[model samples]
Target: MSVRSLSATLALSAALVGVGVPTASARPATYELSGDAGGSKFEGIGYDARTQRYYVSETTGGEIHRGQLRSAAATEWLPGDGTDGRWTARGVTVDSRGRVYVAGGPNGIDHPGAPDLWVYDRDGRLLAALRTGVPNAFLNDLVIGPDGAAYVTNSNAPQVFRVAQEHGRWTIRTWADATATIATQTGFNLGGIVLSPDRRALVVPQGNVGKLWRFALSTGTVSAVDTGAADLVNADGLVQDGHRLWVVRNFSRVLTTLQLSSDGRTARLASATPTDPDRVLTTAKLAQGRLLLVDSKFDEPTAVPPYQVITMTPPRR
Candidate 1:
């Protein structure tokens, strides 16, 4: 279908299904890291419940760092040795098996990696570097699907790539393409992604446009979500639990939570809580029953040393 038709359909759905109000509030705590490893530009966040570890990826050099839930120190899991000049990290996520997945891409138009996913063991050993095979793909935030598949969003493209282990070897494929609507419009499309509660579909947001969408894996269908607000500008990272989805607006400097429908097509704004205005925050994850966020500070004049991961309770309904 065309983008216009799809948008009209979505509008009808929003009107028929009904929309919910959004609430804004604030309550958070900050944890500082020990060294320069903490200062480099960081973006993604992931948590391993079994080991009680939190993982973050640096945007400057594709370095992976790990820290304990309550520790002030964070150590480098993968050093940013600049193996490839263009190598930069975006999103980091951990699976139930304790494996870590880090997204890598170019830092700018001049420097570009092959847009890959770096899979590592729990101890930070490089297990595999699976290339997305998509041209100029900015592989961003990712989520592990119910069937153990890894689905990654491409900020430069209008699609989500799926990576799954097959016969002990990992393979990558384009799970669904959001070719219509704002998918291919421009800048930072398909930023953060998460699966539905039932795992039958995926929900995603466009960073530049502040629009949310749902893609059905079974039928390759796409639909818009009624955010109630005109725009969720700078919507960067997304974390979901049960029926709630938390979206981090990097430029807005706030974390907004939305209550999603079971099908993942619709959401009502639950709350928008203020984050540290001095630090540009990106991704978030649930650790120890609290929400943890990374201070990416991507747009700051000079990155301050001893970066931090802030923890807080999700705003109440």
Candidate 2:
């Protein structure tokens, strides 16, 4: 890393955060956020239903930072603890028991699994390590199912796989993989993955095309969910709340809300309202009807502002 990058990361190391509860509304609204100073670049994020806290990953290095969202732009971040100040924390999720599962190895593209996953408890204590089941494990993100299975996003093989608890450890298999619906549409990077409330469908953000893809487990087929998905609005991260589907599009820099079809066949805009968009996206259930979002791309290293996580209140439920 360059001096600029090293110095930026150190800044993040010394930064202090607080833990507090944020207020909510009938329907969620989006809240824009303050930008990151040096490094603080993020890869994945998740919401912890049990604690109402948000977990974010810093791909710049190890460190899946935890934040207590007290309100829009108001957050408390945990300190990085490990060799270089914590493991390489990326893509995040919280199990029903509230244990956090994070992709912590193979920091960038083309990198394969070297024990790519890590598990932590409510206090950020390391609990266990999970190897990205794939050979060239470039895990982008992950989601936990009702059965407690971990569905991880693999950016390399370009497919998602299921991780089950076995032999007293997390194991991966093709049971779900064989059941996935392949996208007829090609030429896009697949990142972020989330399941519908019904757990019958898996939704992913096709990073290159700026759209969301819904994978039907029962049918074994994939297709675009939004008419605007193939269009170049720059969709990045994803998450679902109740019947609401939320999307974050960069370039246009807007956060959109949609109503999901019961069958997971379609999603449509829920409100005329939209929030300022950024390079990164992810959703979390904070308080009952509220959500917390992080925008890692405030300014680009080349294009605009340095990356940072933002807070957003989705349209009121």
Candidate 3:
């Protein structure tokens, strides 16, 4: 279906479901992204609350698109066609200082001279791009740690990389390795990451196995999270507000909600909500009091344009 027709259908569906259309003065319910000729598919999203701008990554070619809370469309911020040695990009996050960190998924696995991640300043200037020096490393998603460093998840292995500027230079090092605790799987292992409510540990989901693990910030110890009987398979992006956590299962088309404990060791399944049936919602970020989800279009054999980022009301705890 064409973009216009698809949009109209979505509007009708929303209206039928009791979601009224936004007025002209209100923020747009959907933000359109520029299309790529060779079937562009998006995955990750990052929001800069300070600047009111959000970034989306194109998996087909590592291009980055930027949009604002007031705008209805996003423009390509960075070219992806092998620019800066990045052929494909995945997760993104903006730190307090406005530095943008992008995870290059499998970009450096077998390719020589490709970076595993890239860091850009607020003004879109390249700051650093370095490889994680791990074979078959698939850096999927990342989150800024409490110490202002980027903690990236590796899907190919049970490892988290610490990217930071120490002394005066930038460096990438293995911050935590849970090979003994978390076994390697055929598909993506550790996908989405978020900090606990108390900010003492990192909550990471093993997507392939539908399991959650807590990585201690102080000691880097890994422990299994007790998610009793909650099927969180294909969990992609995660958003946390207080003790409530929203897990976006991309292929499953369901948003699983969980209430975490103070220390982030255990979780109780609160609710499971199904998303839109048409779009495969991947990573999401909370901006302007709404949840902006990336309609990755991964389920499509050849993605149909124009691509989009959809908005929805966040689930209340």
For TM-score, the strongest prediction is 3
Compute the lDDT of residue 33 as modeled in candidate 3: 94
lDDT of 2 by residue, 43-76 (tens): 5677776666667776554555565444433242
- Per-prediction tally of clashes: 0, 30, 0
lDDT digits (tens) for residues 31-132 of candidate 1: 555436334677888889998888888776677778887565678777764643325788888999999988774443335444377788897677777776
- Candidate 3, residue 155: CA error in Å? 0.1
Residue-level error in angstroms, candidate 1, position 222:
1.7
Candidate models: Cα lDDT each: 0.74, 0.56, 0.88
Model 2: per-residue Cα lDDT at residue 214: 73
Weakest 10 consecutive residues, lDDT, candidate 2? Answer: 16-25
Which one is best on lDDT? 3
What local lDDT does model 2 show for residue 263?
Answer: 58
Distance from true position, residue 35, model 3, in Å?
A: 2.3
The residue ranges of model 3 lying beyond 4 angstroms of the native Cα positions read 1-25
Clashing pairs in 1: none
**Prediction 1 global C-alpha lDDT:** 0.74
